[model samples]
Target: RGFFTSNRDGGQGYDDIYKFLETKRLLCEQELYGEITDLETSALLPDAKVSLFDSRFNLVSVTNSDEKGNYSFNVECGKTYNVRAEKIEYTTKEQKVTVDDKRGKTHLPIALEKSTCKVAIGDDLGKCFGIKMIYFDLDKYDIRREAAFDLEKILDVLSQNPTMKLDIRSHTDSRQTFKYNEILSEKRAKSTINWLIKNGVDPSRLTGRGYGETQLVNQCADGVKCSEEEHQLNRRSEFIITGL
Candidate 1:
């Protein structure tokens, strides 16, 4: 006699056990297990989606890697299968395996390379360099000694990428006359660029523009009264990536 389980109607529970004189034992499956990791660091990645597909390209099963980056699936013996692993911000990996007639388990591990942005055209150098703005005294257009620290970051990027080009945008608070502010901002922008040129940056890779009071960040325009902090926000400088 053999023991078996059935979920047929009128069963006392979800699955009821029964004794039978004739039955067939099932042993046509093999266990497949593996881990997912970062290609560069080899660090295990969790919650990565794992998929199994048959020889005909039909999806068989799907599972997610556990917190330990481990996943498993049961595949039929003598059948060829495809396995795929994927996660956000990483490249996907696909592999093929065959479960031989000999009953045994299979092990597979996949690593994915992280995605990166090599270069960005609209990237702001000031923000990238971790500085708010290059400092300049009132009515002055010369590069201050304090600004060197932040300016050096731009120099480094330009030196590393010789073919890269940048554009400088300068603005000032509405405390000064419109025309005067325009001229001062232009000088400030040029002064910022000149420092780069003096430090080995090519002049052809740099361009300067002065927006003056035209691009007031807040409502602190000519006739508007604003707090010192609010007005300070209007005074700024930006270096934008113009080309690769």
Candidate 2:
């Protein structure tokens, strides 16, 4: 018999408990059991929500961790599950777990780490230390919405360090003419640099360069058919901390 248990309170919460059990009964019809734990300093986090999603990243079920930071849910076997944890003042963590027919239960432990660096800004910003590789879509100079979040992080770092200089370099997949890609990549790099300048980052501290298809991170050579993801890797914008 499968059941739900928590150490927070006794029988007073039976109403919610019964409802949860009924949902679990329905879930058990097509799902296996999953146990999750937070391994951060052994501190219990009550009411932390745990959601399980399938291979396509669609939510399958949801549960909450007890005061002891423990959560369990019934999930389908032979499916990939993406587990996500959320809490205030702590960065969200995600992990992909696969369940197989041979296993009746899955135990997963997650650790949440803290961010230590101060935000960068203004004249002191030129001293920012971290350089991140930003990715882009095929032949597109415009930054993707997903890339904006990362750029914001970089902006925060720059805001904290006022005297830093960053060189923005753009690259493209080896599918186009060298001259064409070189010109397009340079334009892309400049576009990104312009975006930073417009967003409060100092213009003098930034430079842009286009490397075209000259820098290949993978083996897919020019004129060869490759996966979109592979080609996407070639189309990237990266930052280098050249001066501080």
Candidate 3:
């Protein structure tokens, strides 16, 4: 067996080691090879990250797709692995693989779909796709199921780009006192950050803020008569990418 180190700058400025071994053929061992491609057009995605995890969720190995979007891994007989492919602005693709008790190489192809949320740097709070103004119940700071579902997309973007940082901001309508709204919106923002942290996002990459009816989308301000729909628009949450 021999170890080869390459200065493959997979965007992280780090070295990666590749192992090579020469051995006799065994009936119970095999290797897995595959490529990552776009699910819609079937075009290859370069620099996509491929990760192999064991049954207990321990990370076994990680590699970046080459220019051709190709990746590979070696395995033993009957061992199970969860293979996940991730890329920025794309929905993660996952598959379960188990090597059969036969010799030879196995092929496992992965396809990732473009994410509905096209999150980009310098994008305004609600400008991105799949990101809408999150509304909350009256005076409530807890996260709703619908809000949680939408937040997952933002989480995916943050997870794939580890160096990215965001500020989770919350707002409220003029129905409540200014001070009260401010405090409530702050809690709401904290709640959003907490949910993301609980779902495996790093806390260092996130911050919470409450604008408290300060940045109204329209003229629905205090002493102004507005429809319920207009008021709902003011009570919202947003995610802003603060750093790269």
Most TM-score-accurate candidate: 3
Find the candidate with the highest lDDT and give its number: 3
Off by over 4 Å in 3: 1-122
Candidate 1 vs candidate 3: the lDDT winner is: 3
Q: What is each predicted model's overall lDDT from 0 to 1?
A: 0.79, 0.68, 0.80
Off by over 4 Å in 2: 1-132
Query: For every model shown, what is its TM-score relative to the native structure?
Result: 0.49, 0.51, 0.54
The best-first sequence of candidates by lDDT reads 3, 1, 2
Candidate 1 lDDT over 1-244, as tens digits, reads 8789999999999999988874675668888889999999999999998988786656789999999999999888788988877776664567888877667888888897784535588888656544457756667777754466457556655765688899999989888788999988898788888898898988999998998878877899878878887886777678888988
Compute the lDDT of residue 199 as modeled in candidate 1: 88
Residue 169 CA error for candidate 1 (Å)?
0.8
Q: Report the C-alpha lDDT of model 3 over 77-159, residue by residue, as the tens digit.
A: 77888787888877766788887777777889999888775456666534654455677887889987656645755676666
Measured over all alpha carbons after superposition, the RMSD of each candidate to the real structure, in angstroms, is: 19.7, 11.2, 15.6
Q: Give the clashing residue pairs of candidate 1, or none.
A: none
TM-score of model 1 (CA atoms): 0.49
